[model samples]
Target: METVRVNLGSRSYDIALTHGATANLGAFVRAALPKTSSVLVVGDSNSWPHAESIQATLTRAGLRAGSAVVPAGEASKCLERLAGLYDALYELAADRSTAVVAVGGGVIGDLAGFAAATYNRGLPLVMVPTTLLSMVDSSVGGKTGINHPKGKNLIGSFHQPAGVWIDLAFLNTLPAREFISGLAEVVKYGVILDAAFFAYLESNSHAVRTRDPGALLRVVTRSCRLKADVVEQDEYERTGLRAVLNYGHTFAHAFETCGGYGTLLHGEAVSIGMECAAQLARKLGLIGDEFVSRQTKLLDALGLPTAPPTRWPADDLIAVMRRDKKAVGGQMRFILPTRLGEVKLFDDVPEPLVRTVLESAVSR
Candidate 1:
């Protein structure tokens, strides 16, 4: 197992990455949260078996373990499902010590983590992210929330998990489109922070696409550590440093919201959003065609979309973007790239330029 520690003083935790099956999940949980006596495993329908296995392991370790399963999809991250999760916790008689293990993708993490954060004023939380997207990004950030009708992640909290357990075996079961969707976030890390890593992805694209164990290990390990470095500096968005992680999210979230949840996967929106942001950056003279070409080539090689779905009209997307959390005082902000390896948040973006990017939606 490879371990990356998120050093956040008292809120610090370890992200454990393993290739396939492993024993001693109980030990992993106990090591980080010895005080926990019981656990409520929250998973979606597709990941229930993994959740069942986790519950049995924890129960065998002499801790009470229970599980709740919701239908698998973006729709699951809603007020109705969140209320159901609260009911599950109450039925399990879970307390502050009874850790909530989010077993599945990003949706489960957000739903369960929100419950753990609010129920009984916060319960110990453990993340068992089974999807590549959640494994590399959402699982490590401690930013948990359910989506509201108006926006994505509109209701949430900064409740860090006690530990994160990642087993890449889950990738074997993920659909091809879902797996490709995940590469978008992986690409975002390279764009916003690591130049070498971007070049590495370009060179080793075949290996990662083939699911070579070594490439995946390096990819997930590096992505988690890069995020940890940022989260350590600004656990909340107070310092504006963490906002860089939202590089393409401003446009992406709007795409997701306008299409309604599940129309486009989160990472797909991120992929298209990155392209829009890059185009907007070019208009602002932050970078030229070369920078945009590099990102477009990588996104294409990974089978990600560079433009929002045509059905998502520019005006509708604009209205949604305006209501996005990143828009302060009804003004838009974006994390635009200065070059290949870094991104800067700009609050002075013009609406017409953004509209042009949205209206153009021409895939390279």
Candidate 2:
């Protein structure tokens, strides 16, 4: 097992990664939480079996445990589902001493983590990410929240998890498209932070596509370490340092919002968002066509979309971008790559330029 630490001083925690790590979920929970605390295993419908197994393990370990299953989809990450979770905790008589075990994808982690953050002031959160996107990104960060009607992640908090347990076994059951969707974030890490990691991915793309265990370990561990380093520096995103992690998210969130949340998966939108950002960077003379070409080739090889879907209008997409969380005073802000392994946040990006890019991205 490999361990990566998010050093938030008082809120510090470790992300443990290994094959079949879920089998040791009880031990991980025991170490971080008190025996007196009860555990609420919040699972998504697709991952309820794993949740049940975890609940059983926790019960056998002498901790009071209960399980709640949320439907599997982006829609579940909303205020209504959150209220349902609150009701579940209330009926279980859970209190501050209760810990929420999020046993599914990013949606589950965000929803359950938000519940843990708000319930009775706060409760401990244990993230057991069942999806690649959750494992590499959402699960490790203290960022948690349900989606709002206006925007993606507009109603979230910076509540860090008590422990993050990543089991490679979960990937075995993930749909091909879902698995491919996650590579967008993996590619984001390489684009904004690690050129060598990007090259490694390019060379080992086949291994990664096949879900080879060794490649997955390296990918997940390195991705977590890179993100952890950034989170350690900017836990609450107060400083501009953590904004680099949103390399393609500004555009990605816009795509998601314009698609009405359910039309496109988060990572699918991210894949196209990264391409658009790269194109915009090229237009701004920050990088060359070769840079865009290389990134595109890699994304194509990985079976990820590198162009915007035709369903959403370009103008509407730009409007959504203007409302992104990174926007200030209604001005658009973007994390654009200057080159592979580096990016910088640009504010007050001209609306005309953004519109032109969006126009070309969707039409292509």
As for candidate 1, its clashing pairs are: none
Q: Which RMSD values do the candidates have, in order?
A: 1.1, 1.1
Which pairs clash in the backbone of model 2?
Answer: none
In the range 190-232, model 1's lDDT, one tens digit per residue, is: 9999989999999999888878888988999999999999999
The per-prediction tally of clashing pairs is 0, 0
lDDT of each: 0.90, 0.89
Q: Which 10 residues in a row give candidate 2 its minimum summed lDDT?
A: 306-315
Query: lDDT tens digits, residues 1-364, model 2?
Result: 8899889998999999978756677888889876446888999888898888889888987788988898999899899999999998998899777889999989999999999999998889999999999999999889999988887788988899989999898899999999999989999999999999999999999999999999999999999999999999998888999999998888889888877877888889899989989988998999999999999999999999987767577778878877888888888889999989999999957777777888788667
TM-score of each: 0.98, 0.98
Model 2 segments beyond 4 Å from truth? none
